[model samples]
Target chain A: MSDSTHPDGYVLQAYHDGELNDEATARIETHCRDCVRCRNELAELQRLDGLLADIDAPELPRPVWPALNGALRKQHEARLGPAFAFSAAAVCAAGITIGILLGPVGKSDQSSTNGTTWEGPSSMWSGGASASLLEIHLSDMD
Target chain B: MTGMTDDQLMIRGAAGDEAALRTLIERWEKPVFAFLVRMLGSPEEAEDLCQDTFMRLISSSGRYRPEGRFQSWLFRIAGNLARSRLRRRKILRWLPLTSGHHETPAPGLDPLNALAAGQEQERVRAAIRQLPDRQRQALILKRYNELSYQEIAEAMGISVGSVQMLLHRAMSALKRDLSRGRHES
Candidate 1:
């Protein structure tokens, strides 16, 4: 067989691997039978495969599940930890803001209904408190 | 659960089913570890990376589409991690004081070689270790893992033609390397 007619190395390797389709396999088989070069190439590829097959993977020292499970658990917790903390902080902040907004209105309503202005703190504090109460009252009225 | 396919198990695993995850670990751990051990040449590192691969599988399972190619996807994750680990090892090899500590012994030199059993096997392991990473990966995936060309292409994220070429080059190199080893000895 001429050099040009012989299968390429990849095609020969594919043939050795049994990866070629039936038609291609037949073509290669016919060509290799007549071509010493292709036959040598296939033999060399098979020898290489055998050499590679001789090396075995070492045994695992122990079952990986215990350590893997632990790592996964830690990872799962690590993922949820920050989100859980953020959610709790958000809830706390919302609760605090709601208390701040509603506290003065209830207090002012009590003070007004009691007929005595409770001078519990400086006007600076009362002023801010009253401003919040006004905003709530206005919003309610609207 | 054991009868369920990898995609089915992964779907359950994504939904936080511990049993499915366990089943997956049981089913895949050995083959993955073997692949890693060959790729990285260290059973210790392979074991660690195998766990990491499954961990990645679970974490990414939510996005997994069941295409009957779970093994390819699983190996892709493992292959990426192995490549990253190899890169890190290369980088560490350049550092001054720590270089000695991080030197990768040929698999033949590994204490675990006692299990691998022969000097011939050791030479083969060392030859495999010397191949360029992509060629080595393609060769191992095809030769040891018994992946079809399409499956190897999927696992390595290369085309089937690329896989064929890699395997061709890899086998040629191994033949040359082994012949040299034989001549030297």
Candidate 2:
């Protein structure tokens, strides 16, 4: 662009994307019609974009259906009402089960809570739930 | 299935054709997922988010206008999801790509040994990731989505001038990077 022309990179991008208006596009085309450097640069950018087209997508995960399945099942389930209750109930059940399992595992060393040996990774692994996750769950409960 | 355009597919999808919906999803899922993966640098996250976009589409069946292009609509939803993720992080997560290998060879070079497409893809991905977010957006929209400047501007909520400037700057940076490749071994 000349001194009087637009200094904005956006206008140039518009030109590159072929989004410029007729007269403006005509003007830029005219410029490229004469300037070898600008023409070469344009050619180079096109080449780079072509090179970029070589970038293929990442690997698709296995069992991609689960996510899509949930979405699909929920399609009609929402109209029936209380459909999400099972998920909530499952969480509560799991919470209670985890508490029971951990309570026994922690006291297994004492041989008093079911008189079993503690052959676990340690008390740290006993808390299946992370502290933050526990706090978040408790906070939600409250 | 055979005669349907994208808009028709969306309309059919809206009318509860699971197959039509699946077809639509199949058509655009890869590119949108790729867009998200590159943007957020997490394939797992992108997969989750891509599923969410489709979920929204399926659930919002009645809301789509019959007149709009399904591709644009799908992209608008994806763009919104991407924008929300960006806003929450206020950061870029650039995953390196690994798929730029030439099948035969560089036709012009005719070298003895072929360059690995994976490494070339990685280099380009890294260079793109280093770009400022807006420039990256412009470049991705044009180069990946193949949207015109006006469409990209509309999608990005910017002017044509801004899009041009972003592309100009991005190409300049890319040119410099490409030149560096020449200077190295």
Highest TM-score scorer: 1
Specify the highest-lDDT model's number: 1
Model 1 bad stretches (over 4 Å): A1-3, A82-142, B91-117
The residue-by-residue lDDT of candidate 2 on A1-142, one tens digit each, is 5555332444555566677779988877877787676676667767887778777655556434446855455443443224334444576799678778889765555545464322312211122333332333334455
Model 1: per-residue lDDT, tens digit, B58-161?
Answer: 77889999889999998999999999998888833221111122233455565566443466766786778788889989988888889999999999998999
Cα error of candidate 1 at position B154, Å: 0.8
Candidate 2 residue lDDT tens string, B1-185: 84677788888878767667777777777877777676666677778888888888877867888765556566667777876876787764444443222345545643443466545766787788778767777777778888777677767777876777788888889878867975783
For residues A4-115, could you state the per-residue lDDT of candidate 1 as single tens digits?
Answer: 6887888888888889999999988888778887888877887778777765555667777778776765565455555545555676699678768899766655555564
Q: Candidate 2: what lDDT? A: 0.66
**Residue A81 deviation, candidate 1, in Å?**
2.8
Number of clashes recorded per candidate? 0, 9
